[model samples]
Target: MEPDGDIEIFLVASPGLESVLCEEALARGFRDPTVIKGGVTIRGGWPEVWRANLELRGASRILARVAEFRAFHLAQLDKRARKVDWGAILRPDVPVRVEAACKGSRIYHAGAAAQRIETAIREELGAPISDDAEVQVKVRIDDDLCTISVDTSGESLHKRNHKEAVNKAPIRETLASLFLRRCGYDGGEPVVDPMCGSGTFVIEAAEIAAGLNPGRSRRFAFELLAGFDEAAWAAMRGAGGEGVDPAQITFRFYGSDRDAGAIAMSRANAERAGIAGLTEFRQHSISDLVPPDGPPGLVICNPPYGNRVGDKNSLYPLYGAFGRTLLSRFAGWRVGMVTSERGLAAATGLPFAPPTAPISHGGVRIMLFTTEALA
Candidate 1:
């Protein structure tokens, strides 16, 4: 088991947007962040873990590597799991849930391995075990090396704790932020989402422009950890560059949806996010999408695809209408559209430069089709 002073923190990113997340971590001044296969790893202690959960918009969840050891079999795993100083990281008063996974390990039964760790924490540390515990201990046994990590961010970071209303096929806030970054958005200009499902892009743009921390409104599992200092955490949360003044914001984000319910949901979500002043939502169809009266900005949306929503032939007309509206009316505005089918993206004839690597959304592989600034 490693000392609690310098722990390894892993930032879980969506599969295709690892590079974008790495860029975000680097820009945020995480120490020695190395992009790994599934996520980004950084060396830090409790403060760094808390900060990562509070500040990072692209990370889906944060994991703190608490301990690792070699265990060839279930008996060895039980012996070593008992030796870990769980008291150093987990509070006895707070209940925890233990989850485990194994790959190429002699201790092939993940449930059995998890049971050993759970019993150790219960007996050795006197911590209660519950299936619905807010704090989670994740044990991974891969190739005979058993690593224990704690899920510092509970309920995933995308919930953001503000969006109460969602339409069908809502985009996660983490993915929305990454997609915005991929579109070269720097929080400088206006953004418009023609098919805003629940105002995710518009609200995310507003929040970024306002310099609001994505995790400000949420609670984390780390608060229940052993070494948590309430005063210190409060200070850290308060000591930061405050968000932009709503009055000072010059460009407002816009979203329009044909469904009035979606438009209502967007408005409600923006208000709850405290960025309502920086956003505008209207009930309008794609053919009615018009650029706001300002300098050009990125126009982005995650529209329905054939795989999930409707028949391909029916959606082509929607895509075509969307493209024609953008090309004919939104000159000088760049465009980014997310869809699972290339043919649907092509039907728009919007001159997309190239599609990004596929991203899994709702069991469908989707790609972002982007175009250069419209001529």
Candidate 2:
């Protein structure tokens, strides 16, 4: 596997948002992005993989499929894994960890398969294998074929490395970006999140409107890989920040919550993300929520699902008031609400479209209910 040769790049997306991720990949000029069960796959060299990690907002992480071979049993897997040109990808000086998964294959034991690959890499490639290593080689054995891929993004793209504070049940930044896209946001208008916890939607929107790359502040595992060209990577990274000028921006993203602590956390998070000037966070209840001055844009929120024990009915009044406020004041603005309960969404009475497929977040299944611009 040559580093400059075309290879398979997979952009992992949260489940149920695969198509949304495909839209982003297509918009970003990735070639032939076909949506798979868990992510979008495109063919590219190491440079494309870096751009995917750096510019793509909805991708959870980028995986570079380095090698693949047919292996029926443990011995064959060991032989093929050892024959892989690991020197082209993995650095001998940098330690790596091997993780394996098997499905409908002769080599069913994941631990045993991982051990075989680990031994192969360690003995043949001269790279150290550690249980706690920053670089990882993923081995997927499915239906008698073994695929080896590298997780190019060290930390998940959601961990922008700047947000230091978080409120409970916060939406991941990647997920929030997709939800905003689903709401027809094109970075040209404002967004308001009434029950914004940690200000995920607002901060994400502000960054998007300003044309900032989501991975700008974070380091990636690709930087440690063998054959990494620091100068080339720096040029690629520099070109991405050539986005919309903040001075030409006319809209702002807003967030408000009843808890003052949440407001403070959102402000701090925005400041740390380099998006504070374009975003506003306030302490106010849902009943007091109002649209920001400017053209109506989007009203998206991930409110409490009331899934806690004996807490379902307690949130009805809150949802109802939130709905009434939107219908009464936010004319011409679209709404995208995230919740697990259909009844809770209905409580808003905001004329949402039929809910889409359930999206799993933090082990809980939620759906995004969208509406056209309010009448």
Instruction: Give the lowest summed-lDDT range of ten residues in model 1.
Output: 1-10
Question: Taking the tens digit of each residue's C-alpha lDDT, what string does model 1 give over 149-212?
Answer: 9999989999999999999888899999999999999799999999999999999999998999
Residue 265 in model 2: shift from native, Å?
0.9
Assess every candidate by TM-score. 0.97, 0.98
Q: Clash totals for all models, in order?
A: 0, 0
lDDT at position 303, candidate 2: 93
Candidate 2 residue-wise lDDT, 290-317, digit = tens: 8888899999999999787879799899
Our model 1 lands, by Cα RMSD against the true structure, at: 1.6
Candidate of highest TM-score: 2
> All candidates' lDDT scores?
0.91, 0.92
